[model samples]
Target: MDQTTTARAKGSRKPLWTKDFLITALANLLLFFSFQMLIPTIPIHLSQLGGNNVQVGLVIGIFTISSLLTRPFAGRALDILGRKHVLLVGLTICALTIAGYTYIAAVTLILAARFVHGIGWGLSTTSLGTVIADIIPPERRGEGMGYYGLSNTFAMAIGPLTGLWIMQSYGFSYVLLISTILAILSICSSLFIAYPKPIPPTNRAKSQRFTDRLWERSALLPSSLLLCTAICYGGIVTFITLFGHEAGIPNVGFFFFCNASMVLLVRPITGVLFDRKGPEWVLLPGAAFTITGLLLLSYANSNLSLAIAALCYGVGFGSIQPALQAWTISRAAPDRRGAANGTFFSANDLGIGLGAMVLGAIANWSGSYALMYRFSSTLIIVFLLIYGWSIWSYSLHKKAAH
Candidate 1:
C-alpha cells in the first residue's frame, strides 16, 4: 500500500480500548462498588437505629430525589466548569459523607448525609460519562460504552455480597470504613484520567443568558425509554433478594452472580452488533429477552429456574443499555454531550425511585413479589411497543427525507 493509504488505514482504525478509558472504567467501578456496599446495609442500619418501614423508605427515597435535583446543575457544571474539577469535588463529597456515617445515629442526620452523597453521585457519574463520550472515537462508541458499562455491572455483581458479608462478619461500622476507603481509592484513580477540554456551546449561547437549563431536548427520547426499562430494573434490585427468601430460595446471591456474568460475557458481542447493524437488530430482541426473563423470574421455583431468569435479564440489560446510550450520544451535538449524559442518568434514577415505590406498593397490595414481577413484565412489554413505534417513526422520517 502507498504511504498515504497506510496512514489513512491507521487513522481510521478506532481503538476500542485506551488508557484513559481503562482508568475511567476502573474509577467508575470503585465508585459504584463503594456506593453499592451501602445499598443493603443502609436499611438494616436504619432499622437497628429504631426506624420503621416508613422512615427507612424515606431515608432511601431522599437520596435519589437529591440526585435527580442535582443532575441538571451537574450537567451544566460539566460544560462550564470542566470535567476534572466537578469529578474531584464529587469524589471528595462522597468520601466525606460516607465517613460521616460513622458518627451519625439520628434519622434526620442520616437523611442529610444521604442527600449529600447523592449529589456527589450525580456530579461524579455525569462527569465520568461525559469524559468517556469526549474521548471515545465516534466509530467505536457502542463498543467503548459497553466496556465502560461493565464496570457498573461488575460492581452490581460483587458489591452487595461483599458488603453483606463484611457487615455480618464484623459490623456496620466496618462496612462504612471499607466503603469510605474504596471511595478514596476511586478519587485517587480518577485523578490520573485526563479529560479533554469542553466544547463551547453554539446553539444555546444566547439562551444560556436567560433560559433554564434542566433538560436536554436531544437526549429526551432515549432517556425516556431508559426510564421505562429502569423502572423494571429497579424493581428487581429492590425486591429480588426478598422475593428469593419468600420463594424458599437459599442462595439468592447466585442470581446476581449469574446476571452479571451473562452481562460480562454478552456485552462485547452486543456492542459489535450495535456498531455493525444498528440498534434495531439488538434492541428488539433485547426487549424480548428482558420480558422473558421477568416472566421466568415471576414463575421461578428452583435454583435452575432463577438462574435462567438471571441469564435472560443479564443479556437483555447488557445489550439494551449501551445501545440506548450510543443512541443518546449520537443525538446530541458535541458541546451538549454533558447535558445529554446528565439527562440520561437523571431519567434512570427517576425510574428507579418511582419503581421502588410503585412496584413495592404492588407487591404489598398483592402480598407477593412474584405478582409484582408479573406486573413488571407487563410494563416491559409496553416499553417494547413504545420503542418499536419510535423506531418505525424514525424509519419513515428517513424514507421521507430520501
Candidate 2:
C-alpha cells in the first residue's frame, strides 16, 4: 500500500541469497542441531541417573511444555524486544543450558535445566520463523518455506543419529560440549545479521500484546487442526526410540530417518500446494493420513509397519506445518505476524508437550507401549471433533453474514 509498508515487507527481500537471510536461517539450523544433539544422550543420561522409562519421557515432555508456555510471551516479546536481541538471548541460554547438562547428575536438576532450555527454544524458534517470513516473498512462499523448513528437516534428518554416534564413541559430556561449541558459533553468526534498532517498547516496532489480539476465537479450526497434528508428532518424537527398543530393532536413527525420507518425498509437493491453493486443501486430507498412520503405528509389529507408519506420518506432518504457518501469515494483521506465529506454535508445543505427558503417563501406568498408540488414536478422534465443530461454526457465521 504505502512506500514504508512496501519497504518493510520487501526489506532485505532475498532468501538464502543475502548474508542477512542466510545467517538468520543458519542460526535456526544450528539451534536445532544443538538441540537435537542432546536427544540420544538424554536416554543415556536418564539410564545413568537410574530413572525409569516414565522419567525419560517426562524429561522430553518438559522441554516441549516449557517451550510451549513461553511462545505467547515470546511472540509478544519478539514484537516488543526486537528479533536479534531475542534470538541472541535465546541462543545464549541454549548454549549455557546445553553445557550445563555435563554437571547435572541429579535427575531433578536435569529436568529443571530442560524446562529452562524450553524458554530459549520458544524465543529462538518464534524469532527465526518470523524473521524468515520477513525475508521471503509471498509469491514464492511455499518454495521459500520449504527451503526454510529444511533447517529443521536437515537437523531432524541428521542430529539425533549423529549425536548418538558421538555419544557411543566419545561420551555424553563430549557431545554436550560439542553442541555447546556449535551453539556458541551459532550465536556469533547471529550477530552478523543487521537489524534496524527499535525506537521504543516495540517488538522491533511490531508491538502488540499477544493476549489482546490472539485469534483465539477466530482461528479455532486451524488451531484445532494444528493440535491434532501435534498429538501425532508428540507420540513419534517422544516414544519412537522406545518403540525401537521395545521391538528389539534399536535404530534411534530410523525414527527420524523415516520422518525425513517422507518429508523429502512430500514437502516440495505440499509447499507448491500451499502457495497455489489455500491451507484447507492441504490440511484436512493431511489429518486423515496422519490419523491412519497413527492407527497403523498402534498395530505395528515389524519394520514394515514402522516404515509404513513413518511414511504416512511424514506426509501428514510435513503437509500440516507449512499450511498452518501460511494460515497464521494470512490471518494476522501486518504488525502482528510474530504474535501469530507464537500463538500457532504455542498450540503446537502445548499439544506435543501435554500429549506426550498424558501419553507417557498412560504408558507408565499400563506398562505397555501399545496403549500409547491406542490413546493417541483416541486423541485423533477428539481432534476430528474439534475440527468439525470449528468448520461448522465458521460456516454458520459466513452464511449469516451473507
What TM-scores do the predictions have? 0.93, 0.84
What are the per-residue Cα lDDT tens digits for candidate 2 across 1-402?
112223335545334356676887788888889888887788778878898877887787788878878877777666666778888888888899988888889888888999999988888888888777666666546656766787888888889878989988988888998899889988988888886453343353334343564433333456666787786677677777787777665554555688788887777788767666555667777778788878777777777777888788788878778767766665555556667778888878877876676787888998877778767876667766876776687789889999
What TM-score number comes out for model 2? 0.84
Alpha carbon deviation, residue 144, candidate 2 (Å): 2.4
Worst 10 residues of 1 by lDDT: 1-10
Q: What is the C-alpha RMSD of each candidate to the true structure, in Å?
A: 4.0, 4.6
Considering every candidate listed, which one attains the maximal TM-score? Answer: 1
**lDDT per residue, candidate 1, 177-219, as tens digits?**
9999999999999889888887777875537642345567878
lDDT of 1 at 217: 82
